[model samples]
Target chain A: MIAAIRVFGYSLFAIFIGLLFMGIGRKIIARIQLRLGPPFYQAFLDVGKLFARKSITHNFVMDLGMIMSLAGLLSTMLFVPVAGHMAIKTSSNLILIIYLMAIGHLGMAMAAAASGNPNATIGVSRALTMMLGYEIPFFTVMLGLIIFNGTSSLELIAQSQAGGILNWNMVKFPLGFLAAEIALQAIMGEKPFDAMVAPAEIASGPMVELGGKYLGLAFLTHAVSIFVETGIMVNLFMGGASNVFTFVLKQFEIYLITILIEAVFPRFRIEQAVKFLWTVPMSIAVVQLAIILL
Target chain B: MMDSPSYMLSKIAEKDNLTVYELFFGPNHPGMHGNFGYVLEMIGTEIVKVRPNAGHLHRGFEKLMEQKLWVQNIALVPRICVADPDPNEVAYCTAIEKILRVDIPDRAKFLRTITLEMSRLSSFLMGMGALAAAVGLYTAMNIMTADRDLILDLFEWLTGARVYHMFSIPGGVRNDLADGFVERLYKVLDHLEKRLIEYDKLLFENPIIHKRLKGLGYVSKEDAVKYGLTGPNLRASGNPYDVRVDDPYAAYPYLDVRVITQEGGDALTRAIQIRLEFEETINLIRRALKTMPEGEIRLNLGNLSALKVPKGEAYAKVESSKGEFGYYVVSDGGMKPYRVAVRGPSLPAGLLLAQKHLPKMKIDDVAAWMASLAICPPDIDK
Candidate 1:
């Protein structure tokens, strides 16, 4: 029961940190352009507003997609270890996490495509490009970790990283961290990699067509995804923050770096992005592996 | 002689009996803005040919301008190029000013310069923002527009309007700067400088942005000049020509200014040219603020009803942020102009650039290339 409390504490802390960055990202982007932006609680308010909104049904498929999205997120979250242990963990669940993550993304993409809006159609295509580009590096990094640990259990991967922060897997196998870092930013759907949801380009891609309670579900799913993914990254690399405070701080550090990238760069086209992820970072991963073996 | 998208669409029937496809690009497409459309024959993603379709935003300015009083038409013209509207006001007023022979005051000239440069900066921010958005750097684009809102606020404070300023009269400006407006303006400039670094990080140095934008919308200098592309698009093709330098209107003669140009006439070059010119516009605004002389705001328009001019035509052009905007006026010893024809810069570029220049490009790059042309369709249809 004490172990259960720690796991709950970590997930809640991760969610809070993720929500904070989402708000900060919007405000900072506004402030950078000489405007006084939205209030810091804007993200929280937006989510609160989301739940309070009236529910409108478009098609039953939308609910199906919505439920699938939330389920995928919750399933992914369950597999993620908190303090090197999970609320529910299994050895074969790494494969389940991969499917859950991809399906959640696909469900959102399919939902957007089914909405019959032209911009939504374009958004789905962009999402496909992002998924294709990002998943390759993400899985490759996962494979490297799996091989390194000699097991696919996320709990085992988390345990291997712990020996103090300096002896963390990120420090020992810097290339995995480096490669995963690039993929992680893309995975988080941050800017530069956020072409999928480029508001001006396709008017909010994927979720542009979704509205009322439907969009709220998508937003909640995204919030949960961020918490789960950041928690997973911390478990694998940063070694679970030692306490609740440290976990929150580490997740925030990741979020700030993503914001810095967002503040600094324009996005790449799908073709260019594919080339960037597959070649450059994979090469970096190879070099990282060489350093590890040598 | 130009075939419709249907005509070229028909030629596909004879060649291998390929199915003729009619596709619409906008009024709702991801790339289009403020109501635009392109009827094109697209084979997969490659645009075999494109037919330009406009008139969604046809405000009928030629008709509207005739209905409104000469003073009120000042409000009508600026909507031609929403990104840069000051030149619209200037060209129309100057045409009327020419017919009336109103010797605008020295302070009015400087105010015109200030307003024009402010509009230029705001518009440039938007163009760069749209260009970034075209290729999908959304954060950078949002940053630009959200920042552009502040400049619009500044205009609103000065002119009592968010858009359609109607601030410039034929003889002079409507109002002077409110107290501390200049100081606030400087603070905005400082903030803009700092914000540009954030944009630099998110967009300028990012390798993905380069690959997508650069070399994708390549338009040669010959085609650029032939199509009458002006402003940043012309300059991007290595053409150093600017109406500001060539004609030297308003306070342009008093203030020393330089033209910015680039070697490649592509979308990326156009974007870069605009980026560099933004700095120049800021400098011009600062200079106008410093060198502004205290004087009256208007020329002596003692008589409003019996305005007359020599029965000849005078055409005046200004280097608007979008392109070269000109007004042709013919007076017949009357209160209203005999025939007043306003030539907007983006009009021709929209027609020729999309119709002629956009062939062989992928449908995905169409928006980026169109943005590079900076075609304001209302300017054309109006």
Candidate 2:
């Protein structure tokens, strides 16, 4: 019962932090454009409003897919150690976390396909293609750290870099961190790599068919994924914090970098994005892997 | 009755391995400029065929102008192109002046030039913002819109109306420059010039934007002229056919109007052309202000409501932000015009060039492409 309570508390914490970061990100973007933005709690208000409205569902598959998407990301969030606190107290295997994260995307893809909208299908296809683009460099960076530390566990990786800021992987393996940063931008679906969600091109792509409660659920899923992805980045690059507050601070810093990049850059075409991902970050990751091997 | 038509077609499609779907790419889509649509047939995110769906914004503007008296048509002409309405008014008035063979006063000419250039600035801002937004950069859009509001504020101060300023009539503009207007104009110009550096950092210098826009829409020099492309789009394609320079009107003949052109006939070249022309327009306005002479503002036509023109026909054209806006007016010695035909700039590009360029292009490029061409749909429909 205590474990179940802890699990629920962790999910809520992740969702809250994620929503806060999104709101703050919008505020920062608006300031960059020389305008006053919404309050920092606006995402919460938006989610509340969406949930209060009615939703249209195309089929049972769509309903199941939306639920599965949220559930899968939530499950991934449970494995990430928050300031040394684990929800379920498992190994928190890095490979398992990566594998589980994909389930969230697959769930979204299934839902989009089931929606029977051409735009949604195109968005899902681009998303899956983008997955292929970013994963190679991301996994190569992970492989470098795994080989260096001789462990596949995220907790072990974080603990190894716990002595000081200088001991963090970000300082020791700057190339790998750079590659990971680029991959993270794509993972979060920010520009100049946001072709899948290209609002002008495909009428907001996958979200075209989503409305009301379904949109609310989509927002929650996006929030959870943001938390999970940033949490993973903090554990791998920065040393995971000694407390929950500092941990969230570290996650915010990572998210801030992505948001700053997202503010000024326009989207890349899917093929252009894939080509860039393969050449630039992929080369950087390869060089980092060589350094680790050498 | 062996097989239903749908089933037979499906079987044929399956045998051929074709999966083409129709997508309505406007009328309500975010990328669309106005109430215009394109029915696109797609096969795997690439456009297989395109059917331009016009007439969504058709208000019968040409037909509406025929019913109104000569002077009242000034209020209606500006609605033809909301982004750059001054050109429509100027073109209409110039056509009427040509038919009447009356030259507007020198002060009125300078004022008209200033308003026309200011309208060009605001329209260019909107065009660049729309282009940036099409590529998913809302920051650029927001900044440009904020800057455009400054121009609109100036317009309101001068003309008493913000958007459709019915300032220009048959003879001259309705009002003079307001109190301390030139100093305020200078301040706005200085502020915009400073903001250009920030825009460079945020949008123009960004490498991804160059990559996205460099060679997307390649119109050759010959094709540009063949397709009747004009203004910046034509100038970008290595043509120096500016109505302001070649066929001078307003204060253009008196002032030193320098024609700027580019060698590459691509989308990026066109964007660069607009940026360079925006700076040139600022200089043009400053020059016009400096050289403007104080004189009468209009030719007294005597009771404009009951005014009549001798039976004649004349055509007048002006360099709008989009391209050449021409008004062909025919008078029958009556209070109302016999015929008024507007030659809008966007019709050829929106209807003709799109047919040539849109097929085989990916879905993502459509919005950016439309924005690069600066295809305003209202003018096309009108």
Model 1 CA deviation exceeding 4 Å by range: A1-21, A24-36, A39-60, A241-249, B1-25, B28-31, B39-51, B101-107, B136-163, B175-206, B285-296, B303-312, B357-360
lDDT for each residue of candidate 2 in A1-294, tens digit (9 for 90 to 100): 999999899899889999999999999999988899999999999999999999988778888899999999999998999878899979999999999999998999988887877788899999999999999999999999999999999999999999999999999999999999999999999998999989999988888889999999999999999999999999999989999899999999999999999998999999999999999999999999999999
Please give the C-alpha DockQ score of model 1. 0.23
Q: What is the lDDT of residue B317 in candidate 2?
A: 96
Model 2 DockQ reads 0.57
- TM-score result, candidate 2: 0.97
Indicate which candidate wins on lDDT: 2
TM-score leader? 2
Poorest 10 consecutive residues of model 1 chain B by lDDT? B1-10
Per-residue C-alpha lDDT of model 2 across residues B1-382, encoded as one tens digit per residue: 2354334544655765758777889988989999999998888899989999999999998888889999889899999999999999999999889989999999999999999999999999999999999999999999999999999999999999999998888889898997899999999999888888888777788788899999988999999999999899999999989999888889899999989999998888988898889999988999999999998888899989988988999999999999999999999989999999999999888999998899999998999999999999999998
Give TM-scores of the second chain, every candidate.
0.92, 0.96
What shift in Å separates residue B85 of candidate 2 from its native position after superposition? 0.8
Can you write out model 1's per-residue Cα lDDT over B251-285, one digit (the tens) per residue?
A: 88889888887898777777778878888888888
